[model samples]
Target: MKRLLLSAALFVSITAFAQTYPKYTNEAGTPKSTSKPPAARLKSDGTEMRSETVMPSRITGDFQEIMERAVIQNKEHNYAAAISLYTQALNVANEEQAWRALVSRATTYQTMDKPNLDKAIRDLTTIIDAQNAPQKQLAYIYTCRGRILQEMGDIAGGCADALKAKELGLPVALMAGLEGCK
Candidate 1:
């Protein structure tokens, strides 16, 4: 009957919607997380507790903590915080991580202030010239450089770099921004 089909369809839709968000798990193979940040943990006494396994506040040696902060700030469009965190991260970032962070932070800079062409160019240039960098990353470097140049009034150079990036296997998303740069 029509009612039976409608009920089944409603159940399927509800199931799909409920499954959209994944369950969180702890590093020690435990479940039942409350979807809060790792800093909020429960103790045996039913009070809030802070554990090394639950909270990674000790990730201070290298740029991991700073990079995580930068990534989160970038997602939230907090450009100043992202810039500061990325700067701290770059101080300890290895060659590989620095290159990626440069690109990411440069993007945030561009989004924050279109007039910050110099900062964007500097970041992209650093990435493009990284020694022994991965070829795929090189493609991304070219794309970022292309955007910087285009924004800085170097139309021809930007288009050239954009074309080279696509030829070097940058994704369509990167190339899509390159459109009209010519």
Candidate 2:
């Protein structure tokens, strides 16, 4: 009798859990259309034109795992291990993931006890030079790099990046540093 009641309770809990959970259509199921609709382009004649949806290449599972581990190491203050793991993740990263990994590494550099701000600038520069990410992300990166430049006494470089970020929709230049930036 006790076993029967326990079994009933387990079944009820499972049913309740299943019903409350949102359905996922990904794993071992039909493919899902996760891509956003392509932007419409106008020809010289001003006619509506359809374009293919641009989907970025997905990063590898290994990249995900390595980044997760790196985050854990970073939170634990294991700077060396975290940086090494972040580098490993970079080697396996795809288009979008490339920016993610680079930014993460740059931040790690910024947070180190004896911070390597120069290396941080280099990593952020790699992202800016790539010019492959969305405008919003580029804006954020520019803002970050600009702040770093300001700290490093490069007022002109900071102003340039800050202005670029403003052009990209994040107007933080004047607030970050007013030096040589009108």
| Candidate number achieving the greatest TM-score relative to the actual structure | 2
Q: What residue pairs clash in candidate 2, if any at all?
A: none
Q: What is the TM-score of each predicted model, taking all chains together? A: 0.59, 0.63
For candidate 2, the per-residue lDDT at 89 reads 68
Q: lDDT of each structure?
A: 0.57, 0.64
Name the top lDDT candidate.
2
lDDT digits (tens) for residues 3-103 of candidate 1: 34423432343243335322211222222221111344478899986521233332233455677778798778788889777766655454445554565
The residue-by-residue lDDT of candidate 2 on 81-137, one tens digit each, is 888777766656655556666777887887777788877887788788877556776
Tell how far residue 124 is off in model 2, in angstroms: 0.3
What's the number of clashes in each of the models? 0, 0
Q: Model 1 — TM-score against the truth?
A: 0.59
